[model samples]
Target: MGDLVLHLDNINKSFGGLSALSDVNLHVEEGTTHAIIGPNGAGKSTLLNVCIGRLKPDTGKVTFAGEVLTGRQPHEIAQLGVARVFQTPEIFQEMTLLENVMIPALSHRDGAFRLNATELLSKQGEVREEAEHILEDVGLKDMMMVEAASLSRGDKRRLELGMCLILRPRLLLLDEPTAGMARHDTNQTIELLKKIKSRGMTKVIIEHDMHVVFSLADKVSVLARGQIIAGGDPQSVREDPKVKEAYLGGTT
Candidate 1:
């Protein structure tokens, strides 16, 4: 196994009197794809929020790359090479797909939000080239100049994925990346993810698609009612009785 890139120890979170996550523990190995699955309201998203610093756990710790991550802001976590893709695609509606990807690269090179107009335009070629490379990687090259809002749903998802990829994050967290897509689109997204994985990215994904999980995950963790019920290789997780009863609805 690779070194641990992310560690969540005894994590717990609650909103008022409602418990969203309780004593949840997980470890993601470097360069491996780890999938977390659960039923609705199972706190899967909550766990992801905590991982990427969007939400803080009332108890327990989050560590990334041997550095303590508790209490860090989302951007701070992101700067530390963690990137998250939300369930809903959040692209700049007015910007071209190339523009969207260039934003991050420009920010990385010129400091966030501080680029002068002249300098920004001067850097545009480099940014566009880099963005186009990422778009190509995500299968979006032909749509580079298209307004993000004008793309089809799958293409928009691809654009969002491209945005995340440009960051070159050490760990990528995705929540329902294939959510709301048609079967063909979902499979395309799956192939894109597989291509990413083959390039040696470490990913932690929260997904409900068993096919995607089984095909891509090196390990699987099944959650129910705020705790992990079973965790192991994908095949074992698929066959795990407790997981079948609690989250998989006895599908196994």
Candidate 2:
């Protein structure tokens, strides 16, 4: 076990007449993968949005590394080392894969698209090297020069992962990183995530793929109707009666 890197206490959120999340409580330990699994409309993504400061909770608190994060803006949270990868892969359509990966690294060095030509040129070598290294780490080294929009769905996801990796975030929030991939690609994605966890990065993932969740998560939280009903080790959660009844539909 390690220090609690992310903590959510009694978090609640609503959209007019609908409650998206209610009394959600979660803690992710440093260097572990914690999975959030639930059926459709379970408020899983909404919870993530709140955690990363894309949405403010009506009540409760979000803390990261001892700092209160309830009302901070998304970019502000990113500056504090919280990175989010959305469900849809967000890549620069016209940019080369290498260039796409370099953007975040450059931002880290020169501050988010604020660089003048001289500053940009001075940091080019280090930023490209770092980006290329991340690409290699994510199995996209050979595709460095390809236009991002031309990538296959799986590779697009890899490129997105590389972008997040370049940030070296303390808390990584992934929304369905494996969605819509072929079986082989899904396994590859899982392997990539495992490699990331091995490097001691903390991850909190929202996923519907049970196989991936069971294989990679050290702990699992079952969310249904905007609340967590079970939280524990993967095997224990897989065996929980309430979890089976609620999300698993009586299947283990």
Q: Model 2, which residues run further than 4 Å from truth?
A: 120-123, 250-252
The residue pairs found clashing in candidate 1 are: none
How do the predictions measure up, each by TM-score? Answer: 0.94, 0.95
- Candidate number of the best TM-score: 2
Candidate models: Cα lDDT each: 0.86, 0.89
Per residue, candidate 1 scores C-alpha lDDT tens digits across 170-210 of 88889899888899989989988988887677899999889
For candidate 2, lDDT tens digit of each residue in 1-252?
578889999999999979989999999898899999998999999998998888999999999999999888777888888888889998898999998988888777765557476564545787889998999998989989999999998889889989998998888899999999999999999988888887788899999889999899998999999999999999998888898889887433
Tell me the RMSD of model 2 versus the true structure.
Answer: 1.6
Candidate 1: segments with Cα more than 4 A from true spot: 111-118, 250-252
